[model samples]
Target: MLKKIYPLVFFISLYSYAQTSVNFTDNFSGIESVLYNPANIADSFYKVDINILSSSTTTGNTYSTVKPLTILKDNKFGLNDLDVFKKISSLDATIDTIFKISKLKDLDSYVSKKEFSEDSNFYGNSTILGPSFLWTVNNYNTVGFTTAIRFNGYAYNFNSELYNQFTEKTYLNNPKKLLDNNFGNLTGYGQAFAWYEVGFTYAGVPIHTPTEFFKVGVSLKFLRGIKTYSFLLNDFTSNFSLNEDVPEDSVLDFNGSVSVSSSDTGANYGQGLDIGIVYEKRNKTLPINNIDKHGNIYYSKAPYSFKISASITDIGFISFNNIKTQTNNVDLNLANSNFAISDYLSIGSNKNQKETYLLPTTGHLNFDYNLNNHWYLNTNLDVYLFSKDRINAMKTVSNISFTPRYESQHISAFLPLSINNFGIYKAGFGIKTGLFYAGSSSVLTNLTNLSKEGDFFIGLKIPIYNSKVVSEYKKGIRKYSLLKIIENIDEEENTDSEL
Candidate 1:
């Protein structure tokens, strides 16, 4: 059933632009570790953080100019020119009737009559809203967990115009001919994706020295995505009426119309893993200045600490259920014989078909250093690896996102600070480059493009305790009550013994 509707679905997919930037702020998979180190979370019980990002880009145009009907015509006729008899074979009678008035003598006429005036000056903007929570176990051994939800949405619109011009004499000779089909309107292509993940990490192994730490974490995620496309056509007319060659009564004039709509909802599921390690020299001796009141030398020592850690994140796959639908009219004769459109323009046929595919899995690597608890800096690199078909199948139509699955990478460095005892703040900058693997795969091939780089992120973190905090507080209360009871009993015993 899906095979019958694949072509229509494929056409819709072609119009969608699914490529998005993977900058420092856009790294949802790394949020847990970046906001709360395992040791910190374990000591504090848990941490909560939220990050928001906005980015924009103007890209160059890169679409081939070929009329839809021309391609179909060539495939059907197997003819190089209109002069060949085979060129008209199997053409629908309605289309053939319109073709009879044309002065188009060859394939070149049809090709040249339409201009490929597509420009790449494409503009896109995106915003990401993310919130996460990380929990810790205890001081000696810390178990941390985090759940982050990220929302990413963006839109791309194009200014495309199609015009046809023919000699006035040709219009006079064939009054039924179309001289101009100039039509232009806004074409909408937008995407929205929501990523929700819950992850847990265990750090500060009891067996490790006081200064050394290691952690491992895993995340299970639920991904929901919604994409919409709006395509409008306008300003279509026949040249015969404009030429005034045919009698008013004999002229057949046609007005242009357009169809605008949205596609189906997209949803998926994904999972990932993250692991980290931190080693610190908590007891370092520094040569101290020797000073005496009268210039005599007395040596004193100072303490120093240094720490380093690394982590990997977002290492899993997202599976997609092919919940595809079309908002425009489907030509039953071309694909499915049973396809029919109701009065409301709803597809009443083949409603039970569903397709399934996989979205690309993305990953990241991070390294950080803490200098004496007052200052810290970290660097992160991320990559997206997938095939072309895998990406295309998941995209909405009218999207011009040309990101193909190859291998794209990004890097950033930031400085984080502890605010009092309850909060932490960080600000940093980064860059992204390469277009190895980006977006859905069906539209393009193994293609590579110039890399793009961008800025860093600014974020804050606060503690949010898990069950451990309540448990610890309860334990303290119980101990205090027990101590009071023992005291009372001792007092009673003393009085009785004294009596």
Candidate 2:
């Protein structure tokens, strides 16, 4: 009965996610820079960074589609909007599209044109960094603290029928193909939840020599899980007929866990850790008296030509107590039936034991080059270390970005060109002036009506030092690759790293 009438039931309130601050890759990165690499706190130019307020949101999917017309006159408008179901179903476009697709398989494959499963996954994170601080304790060390509300969610391994149908738009014509068992097996699972987290970090440039320099950083975090829902399918198979005369029997081997707690009742706590290392080349022969290498005593702020860094972060788990779990087996045989689905699986007996949930641990790789005094290019790659098949697991983010920027004492701007592992191609711009920064991951998508996926971020920061000139501003990016320029610089006997 649930399968016969599922088309009329519009599940508009599902799907959510957000990513890290991809735009904070410049001289004015401020306090939030530690979110990427804790060691950055030691390398940044600012003596101190006080974060005022910062927030981010992201929503995108591969299985379903949302008609992108704004809902006005008492309708919910955004991804996190409260009254999602009513607002989503109110649009005529949404209703017609739903009716035409007419089945679960067709509905699942409504968005993409080809290479279906490659994009039929899920990801989302929402973070609000509040009252964060990063202070340079000395010329070579830095300490920082941050608190934020973070939510993560993901879905993957959907049915192959949708992939076959949507690959050619045949699902739209023959809705029965959406029900054909010959289409292949079905397996999909997803989970979403929110948590509160607080973190402390220490980073420093602890080692220096004639040939190399090294920086190390570590962070510790505390987390409190608020709520969670894990939807799963272990060998699940179902079949239903659109024709009333042809009765159908669908069976499923499913299990699920859902837990909830208000602010007053939520007491689940856990810990996470992050460690990073950085390596850079040092000025071998040419050195300045009080600046480069000569007059250095306790701590000297010397510059390096190139650097590479790596970190494994978020190694921890949250423990939710007083939870329940179930193994559900359903056998639905119906003839000429159409009824609304109130609920399918019931919760098991209350289990007071504590259940642990792991954080979506991440691996980071970074590269920075000083092309010239004022010109630089930075690259960062963020990867999730876990597989999506795990229940209640956070999906990994696979994105590689290159940012080129011009920097001055109080102002800077950059362009980020990114190619995401999930086939999302986007470009965005960011600018920082003294105490603030703003940017979006996909600027052009936010402006157009056909936009499918988008995200925006903004933050405020206060730099401690107010110097008239940016530190060790490089000259040009082209000189690093040109052999003639290096030869000319050697002929001139200029040992300024680049020249």
Candidate 3:
């Protein structure tokens, strides 16, 4: 039976290696998951906006091989255990079936036996920085520009002992021998991903008034991305039982450990598009006929007006090259004659042979109402439609996020209202609901355990100006007359004579 299984195990291992190479699409969409829309650049004033978001979920199971595989029976005839056999058989069948059903047997022919057991726990955290600017080109037109950078990093551990114990013949069905193999130890894997984009937008107001205006805008963006992966496997010293069949409780201990690391990097480039609209209305007065103070009809100023806008960003996509590497520590007894140390020390294959897909574009909506000179309210909603790359990477899992905000501004002092005035000041307090994504939290979830799902923001806005103020004295001096000039000259002559 052992000899019969050896050939099957060899083929299984080879097939696993071919399929286990990390797919670039799996890591490329992390940043694209956060963009709501590209048009946000057109609606923003020349101000910097920074938002921090986080979320997490207990939906996925932890990595554990011991719990999933248990001994049902043990015998002297090669130590029989039905449960472990079933589990290993199921894994092998699943991989083979996928290849056969997909007609990918020829494609998977290149896989090696070691690649078949590349199981590791997957997890990570991400951050995004977005900055935008809008400049008015004329009374009826404006141009906007924005740039965003997204970074993602993750750490994972592979259960190498479990894998080796199940595949190697020497450790079959003996808990003591399995323990001697150091099967539960952890091996680390990690990757860093960065995505950046720069966009340009043009907006114009077809209709404008003292109190209201309507504007529309569109933008084009350039995108660039980079990714790096690192794999580390710790070495170990093993103890073996002289007996072919060992008891479940027999003691076996580890004497030492070893470690090896490998890394690889890849890069790609692409482009996208954005569009948006803005509406603004200010204070207005209504006509009224009535008797007021001192028997005169008086009118009062109207309440402050409202502003609303929406935009869609990253409405496009890009393609890039893929790079991959692997490293591991294998027992000298189990290492195949064909295995080279260099293969376990560095990236050996699949370089410049693959292409990865990026995440989909995003959309955003914003609204604000000014109640009066001293108080105001503001809010925003953002949506991320999962991209094709994300769906493919996650095996077709769908993901989305929604974010909202509210704010209030107060003015402690007021400047006199006049034409061409230059100085203004204001301060405010703001509270925003925590970010919420469909089926999970935002990419920031790993950094914060914020169960409440919201954040509080506080900020200030101030304006300073340089301008000419027309006063009564300056106006009168400008209206110089001949008689005034002669009077000033006579007064000077009298003063000189007296001196």
lDDT of each: 0.33, 0.60, 0.36
Best by lDDT: 2
lDDT of 2 by residue, 81-187 (tens): 34444444554535444433322233343332223452256556667889999887765778999998887766566553444543445656766665543333445
Clashes of each: 29, 10, 24
* Candidate 3 lDDT over residue span 1-499, tens digit each: 2122223333332222111100000001122212333322322222222223222211111221111001111121121456544544563455444334433333223221222233433333232334444553433555655556644333334453455565566656555455444444433433345567676666666654445656677777787875533334453444543334634334443332222222234557777777777676643322211233444221111222666767776566555566543333343332223545543333324445344444444456666565433244445544555532232121111222222222211112111111100011111121221121122221132122211111111211121111111122122223323334666899999999999
TM-score of 1: 0.37
Model 3 lDDT, residue 13, Cα: 29
Estimate the Cα RMSD of every predicted model relative to the unseen true structure: 22.4, 7.1, 22.9
Instruction: At residue 238, give the lDDT of candidate 2.
Output: 48
lDDT of 1 by residue, 54-144 (tens): 2221111222222324433444333345654443333442333324532233333323132233321122223332444443333344444
For model 1, the run of ten residues with the poorest summed lDDT: 417-426
Which runs of model 1 end up more than 4 angstroms from their true locations? 1-132, 144-148, 152-192, 195-207, 210-212, 222-312, 316-322, 327-360, 369-377, 387-389, 392-461, 464-499
Query: Any idea what lDDT model 2 has?
Result: 0.60
TM-score of each: 0.37, 0.73, 0.40
What would the TM-score be for candidate 3 when compared with the true structure?
Answer: 0.40
